[model samples]
Target: MDKMRVSGDRFVNERGEQVIFNGINLVEKDPANDMITPGGDRLYEQLATHGFNLIRFGIYWNKVEPAPGQIDMAYLGRVAAQIQLAARHELYVFLDMHQDLYAAKWGDGAPDWAVQDDGLAFNRSGLWSDSYFISPGLHHAQDHFWANDPASDGVGLTDHYLHAWQAIAKYFLEADNVIGFDLMNEPFPGSQAQEIVQAVLGYAGQRFQVTPDQLMAMWLDDTAKQKLLAQLNEGDTYSAVLQAMTPAVQAFETQTLNPFYEKMAAGLHDLLNGKALFLESSVFANIGVPSALTFTADNSLVYAPHAYDLVVDTNHFESYSTARLDHSLKVIRATQEKAGVPVVLGEWGAYFNQPETKAISEFHIQHVEANQWSQTYWSYYPEFFSSPTAAVLDRPYPQAINGDLRRYRYDPATQQFELAFKTLPGTSRIFVPHLATVELSQLAAQGMRADKRALPGGTGGVLFITADREQEVVLHLQIG
Candidate 1:
């Protein structure tokens, strides 16, 4: 409604403290266009009430410019309206210009024009999975996203997309609560991991003539196998054993992902003028993970990674449990620590089979504590309501994103949200286990029975808190 505050890099307070910046994903819009409808307003309020502070949201290029050079005003209005609503609810925003395999025509639901079509036949190898699309030539091509492909829509296309982002940023960059802008969502340079790497590396000052991308013009190359081999010492047995991944890994870091960010960081600093968040990512869900990026500067650079254990990173092994996921978060935190950049998780969620969402919540909460970081959860779906967001966005609807508050967001197996609240300052119990769905009423009942105190917010007094095995269940009691 009114004006919002702008950001100038640093986000931590004078206290030098880091608190939980719980957020949700906000996606699920028209595949044919790039905008949020009035219908998103109600969800905005619902999200705020449920306690989400930061939101990682997206607007595919297809939606922004359905046809070349043609900007959509209605779509801009829709996006502007969404920002207003988020502002109303005090939700910090990260405007994401998203895409997948070039465009919706490639099957990701983005607008039609973003896809380059350019006679590059449908790889059809892997739709959303990793093993399908990646080829040696693609990996090689990914190694060089800038120079070799000046007009290459894959890399150059972002320049055009930035225009749309600038338009959106112009409207909300001044907003107090609006945080940053995500350049793209799950950027898949298609099977050209090597090519993507080559392009990026060349920009970073390395020169390569063969151009790995030209090698995988067909797409499905299965290069991760060789990429893994490169990780072994030159004379290592694995080189003889299964050297499928050595060069692939080499190109991924030196050429593709690194150079992509270098230009991106530069572009944002130049075009956006350090206005919004320059959040960086290693790869989409299925690509390899670099230890760190080349451009690890300050708060303006939100170093992020979409961490998924069984689903994306590795094959869907039997290790689809909470413990493995926790370990995965730790690894990501370690990478963030090494980079010396503010971190934000762009995407992380459980498979549909995980009956309860306790694991995912615990993973997030533990990560915040471990890194003392702030993050924008994977999705904030306003459409499919259920299909897009992670598993934790159900019942009691987690609407409040407070670092000082104790409330767990419950995303029902059926896509509803239930948020329950409890406190620990005034009650007898001090170690209230921080969890979701643990009974606040039981503690309230106990506090009432114990005559703990006469508090204003609730009848009972504050209590202590501790962790429960299941993340959502915190154990607590009343204050004296």
Candidate 2:
């Protein structure tokens, strides 16, 4: 439960040990549940058993401030209770102010008082996200928010959001496990979204020798959707589309999103203390478009981007493409290099009840390990406890490294976990899930001593390792 801070493009604990956050998001957008994700000891205990060390906890503006100039202490108390529960299991928490179609009226984010639609019309679609493209009301609402329009109290909507963040940070300042705050979730470009979409369509249209209108119709058709997705899977095709959207994406990120983040950071600077600020790219950058977000090196800032396939929400496993996912992640990684900050992939794997996504999960997990980046999967569901994906999720990972981590990987096929790092002065810890039928086998160790101790619930055991000296250390172990 040590406080976390960015250390040269990595997250290090109070002890200065490298920390890798791996867990799931707990977002309960439905107001019917009182705006809190339902869980208790059993949930957090299970998460710990599965080797998860972080939770991107979701909070909503509507619940935090039901009315302008009012802070919802009661609602925050409920949220704090949950954070305390998670902390009991040694899980880190970061508050994510989540949104979808701009406001709670359409999705779950801004309060009703904060929405200014200019009386534009809104029509719901079968796929809730389609509203981003079809609803003029949603566009106008977001445009007003980005413009920082004055509310009934003569306060700007963005200012009100900053006020909400200040109150939340103050409430959780004492919660050691509550590490930081995610400024926003998947910020869309409001009316400018149309421009990006049109640009992409135009780029694709030229390739297919069709007009943008024709391509739009094709995108709307179910059968044509698969073909378009396949076409995009082609390396050159996707790259060109991303190239076409880059200009607009860069414009919005530089002109609007960058300033918004800076304003939020400035507003919260005095209160942040050791807590970090989680920054997310525009929704357009979620796929593969390179983010043009620029920031001076600051220890408190973390680049938290979300990656999703075009076929994410729908159950189209056959249409899933690893190439596309890899391409998108590579783009985000480039942005991280430019921003010179650590990355915690805020959202991924919205597989939702799909038992056949184990391969997809494995690919992503391996990619994350290879890059040495932190991640919290898209969401949590009861099915996660007993799904094909669960087996993949409950794998060995370094909880903390005493020094620079060169590499780490867990090959499920062989039940082997390997790690290489340059040794420092602290004891390194790795989470080894408890196996019902077999004990752990320390196949080899080059320059370190290893010990295993079981956790209270038999969910897993922490493999404690200490280096022999200040040099490169390698470990090879297996759980079978």
Candidate 3:
């Protein structure tokens, strides 16, 4: 397959065929481990067998540059070997410079030397994300990094980051099946951390009509923080709270996060010319907040955002609520449409062990299908292909289309798949995995006919169809 480029809310290949990316996030993540192993090759094969066509591969800064001014060729070679392995399986890769709370000392991404905390407390508040709200040391380190404050060696953090990115780009610029870089994982605003937390609390309180004194109590009292944490732990959506905080968070994204992205784009100008730059919004946007970031003229830009309900991490999937899901989809789609860029749901479905996991996964997949959007599920670790979640995650879909796709659906119970699209000169193909027999005799279309062919190595089959120019086509297939 040729390289993909963004074209008006869709991704098109060099041949102008619309391409939809369906894949998973693959990351060894630990710097002490090899970048790619024989196990990784097996995993890639499993992904291909499950009909995945791409991978949002994680590459950490701590691994690539263990120290200041040093580029680890061994690490780069491992990454390259993995890229080659992905190519062999016909899977596209987008390197994600993955990070959590900034450095390896706290979470991941930056090298230990780059962390510039001022001896502040690094306590955890039980929840992994609460550190962002409570850790002064984390806040200080992030603030310094964002401000590009000088390290012990006097080099600015952003400058070092730029160098790291440049080195990565130089290594992968001409590599096969390597799409581009996901500049940053989830950008957290660090300046005025306490004030920002207070502001959000105040906003949520006001929405709940709490008195000023009560709001102040929530901000100042540890008991109140515990109460709030209890609510979150109990699977409270806190919809009113999140809604109230949306505007303030969006403002932060506009004033702080977007500028950071702009800087990264400017720094990577030469290296990312024809490659897709996958951009993610602030962490708050995962809960239905609007994104104010836009890259209007940069056709290589892709709005790659993560999605999760507030109840995420509670081990019980929030019941499938269309109203809740629709709100998030609407907000994100509005942002993408406003920016005139295609969207790829970068990280979702971390609820692997949740009781409602399959339902939630199906809900997200349904939305992706309806929106004609591309997606990479949050992870492919510990290998859960035979788990209940796999029933929804591992399914068939149209991989490439010759023209605009109208809609598609797959009913797990019936083992029936349907797709609708407007026709072009080229052919359209659907990936059907784990099917011993596929019946396309009932396939219905206005101007297209379908034929079933065995996939490479006969792991599965693909239903190939050719459509007349300007004709609308629909296909149906049953698996037994």
Candidate 4:
């Protein structure tokens, strides 16, 4: 459970081995259950058994500070207890200050005492995420938060948020396995989102030879919306729309989001010595818009973006397109290049129980592997192992590399895992799902010896390989 640090677009452990985290999200937005998701110990045990080494653990600001100036130790204790459970099972975790529409009343974020909605009506719309576009209450509250509006006790909201993070950090100062803090989850641009939407619609209107108003009408119609999403299945078509909205999106990110992050990170940077700050782009970026996010603090930072298609959070899961998702990754990659940070996709794969869930998960995993980016899938539940996605989650991966990883890929269909790296003096670890039947080829004859130890649950095990000679080497494993 050594600390993980950002090392030139890669996560490296205390032993200096490059680490790639393959994991799932553990989040609970419901307040009735005290904002804690019920998984107990078995949940983490299953995640570890499935070869997951990371958890994008969600913690709400509402739960952190239910009232301004009143930090909740009980809530922090509960969250810490879960992190301990994850650590007990050898899982690394990063805390995501999860929010949806900005406040606990709308989604799960700021407390009720902190929400300054200005008496605006909350218009519940088509989907849960639709409120981000249609609810004035949400926008108003978010605007105040970004503006650092004074709360009932007269302290600014953003200031309170920074304080909340510091409190959380102090609480977990000794929690060695708590790797980092995802500053915020899916940060929306308050009321400026309308301008971004207009930019997209304006570009789409001209492309379709219709007015923005007319396009809005079509978007509200279910069948027409599905057809519109289908049109975006073409990568070029989706890229064009994303490019059109880039200016507006960039303005909000560079002007508003970047400053907000700077302030928060500056306040918390001293507390996070070895832990990286996970930065998520604007919520609009989830659908493929490029971000202009940049951090000025000279601390470890990760380009943590959430990639999803327009079909997410809707009943139109069948309309999900890899072309669109591929384009989304393209945009996120551009942002990552600009930031020059390691990427850990904080959220993806929310296609719940779709007939294509397995295919969709596999497609996303392949791209993630190709890019060599770490990721935490959207979520985990008690019965998550029974889902089609669970199998895809257990695919082989390099848990930690002793040297620079040239490339790695796992073909589930063939049960073949291949890894190429510049060998160092120490052992490199790989997680093989079916370790007992795993057979090493080529490398075993090339002065490399693999020590396989079955993990606790016996479903998977780690292959620790040490090379006799220090040079570039490729190891292939047949795990079927």
Q: Give the per-residue lDDT digits (tens) of candidate 4, residues 425-476.
A: 8899998887778765545775688788887865788888986667998877
Q: Give the poorly placed runs of model 2, Cα more than 4 Å off.
A: 435-447
TM-score of each: 0.62, 0.97, 0.90, 0.97
Considering TM-score, which of the candidate structures 1 and 4 is the better prediction for this target? 4
The candidates, ranked best first by lDDT, are 2, 4, 3, 1
- lDDT per residue as tens, model 1, 208-243: 232445433322333543332233223333222212
Q: Which portions of model 1 miss their true places by more than 4 Å?
A: 1-10, 13-19, 32-38, 109-114, 125-127, 130-158, 189-247, 270-276, 284-288, 296-298, 312-319, 322-327, 350-357, 380-480
Error of 2 at 63 (Å): 0.6
Summarize candidate 2's per-residue lDDT along 107-211 as a digit string, tens digits: 889989999988998878766787789888889999999999999999999999999999998898878898889999999998998999888888888898989
Better of 1 and 2 by lDDT: 2
**TM match of model 2 to true structure:** 0.97
Clashes of each: 106, 0, 0, 0
Residue 337 alpha-carbon offset, candidate 2, angstroms = 1.5
Over 4 Å off, model 3? 35-38, 206-239, 318-323, 444-447, 456-459
